[model samples]
Target: MRNVLEAKNINKYFKKPVLFHVLKDISFEIKRGEFASIMGKSGSGKSTLLYILSTMDTDYKGDLYLNEEHVTGKPSVELSQLRNKHIGFVFQFHYLLLEFSVLENVMLPAKKLAQLSHEEIEHNAMQKLKMLHIDHLAKKRANRISGGEKQRVAIARALINNPSILMGDEPTGNLDSYNAKNVFDIFKQLKEEAGLSLLVVTHDEDFASKTDRIIQMEDGHIIHR
Candidate 1:
């Protein structure tokens, strides 16, 4: 299988009151179609690592590669373009536009990419909503929905651009056990059917164990893979 992301000797530091090393020589590879989780305590720097992987944080001392392209230290504009094309993000809080209808929120990324016409973008947005079993809520205002529904809608929006890798930062954190499982099942399907790589930063052990692999971290270092 092909590797979708690779990190080599990644190191991140902070210099405020005192110099500190947040990440130390972190390295890992995620293969295509894999559903993997990064697990650690609150101070373990898991979120920091995920942020760097998202291509939005490039101040670390290491090499980062996505889709076999060396993306370390790339310019902001290039990283922005790369992120739009190859990455999709879901946060603990589903950051949907409350005033907009669910369909509109999902279509925003596709519209920004502008690779498709209005009609095509609409169709693809609906397709993603249906795939997540949220098509029935497509026309409803985002704020009118429940938390679980909002998170599902966020996932749908993330998929609208057909990103190669689907990333989640505590995607199920806001949902109850039932709804959390519901969202995770859809994630598994996305990995299985579309061959998309999934990298999730989460604290739920039950959820993490079900994924293909769990990369455990402690004290800013990977403890297990």
Candidate 2:
């Protein structure tokens, strides 16, 4: 199978405040339909690596490919388009607009994408919510839902674009164990059932252990995979 994401010889430096190296000689690939996690302690640079992989941090030195297309050095506008089309993101916080309805929040990404008609976007958003079992909360205000429900809404929003890869940064860091497991199971189902690729940075050992592969990091370097 083709790789969904690949990084070759990635190196990053924080030029300010003493010019420190934050990531060193990192290289990895996440294949289509695979589920993986990055695990490390604070200051380990796992989240930094994830940001690069997500195409949001373009200051690093290396080659990055998404779905076999070389993306390194692409113009920011082009990268934004590519990211919107192929990458889904779920962060530690839901970051939902509190006043919007859940359906509107879920539809926001697709609206920004603007590749589909209004009817189609709404239909797709509802489909995603239904898939996540959060359709019942669609008309409710985003802030009115429980934390777990809010996260589920976020997942639905991420999937609305049918992205080639889903990326998460400490996605469960703010959730309880039950909600964390729920998120994990949702990710697993998305992999097994929908054939989606996922790369998540997490500190939870149990969460890391359950994924198909764990890329362990230490002091800006990948120590294991």
Q: Which candidate number has the best lDDT?
A: 2
CA displacement after TM-score superposition, residue 164 of candidate 1 (Å): 1.0
Clashing pairs in 2: none
Please list the C-alpha lDDT of all candidates, in the order they appear: 0.94, 0.96
| CA displacement after TM-score superposition, residue 183 of candidate 1 (Å) | 1.0
What TM-score would every model get versus the actual structure? 0.98, 0.99
| Candidate 1 segments exceeding 4 Å error | none
lDDT tens digits by residue: candidate 2, 62-148? 999999999999999999989988999999999999999999999998899899999999999999999999899999999899999
| lDDT score at residue 86, model 1, on the 0-100 scale | 91
Per-residue C-alpha lDDT of model 1 across residues 46-95, encoded as one tens digit per residue: 99999999998998999999998999988999899889889999999999
The candidate 1 region of ten consecutive residues with least summed lDDT is: 155-164
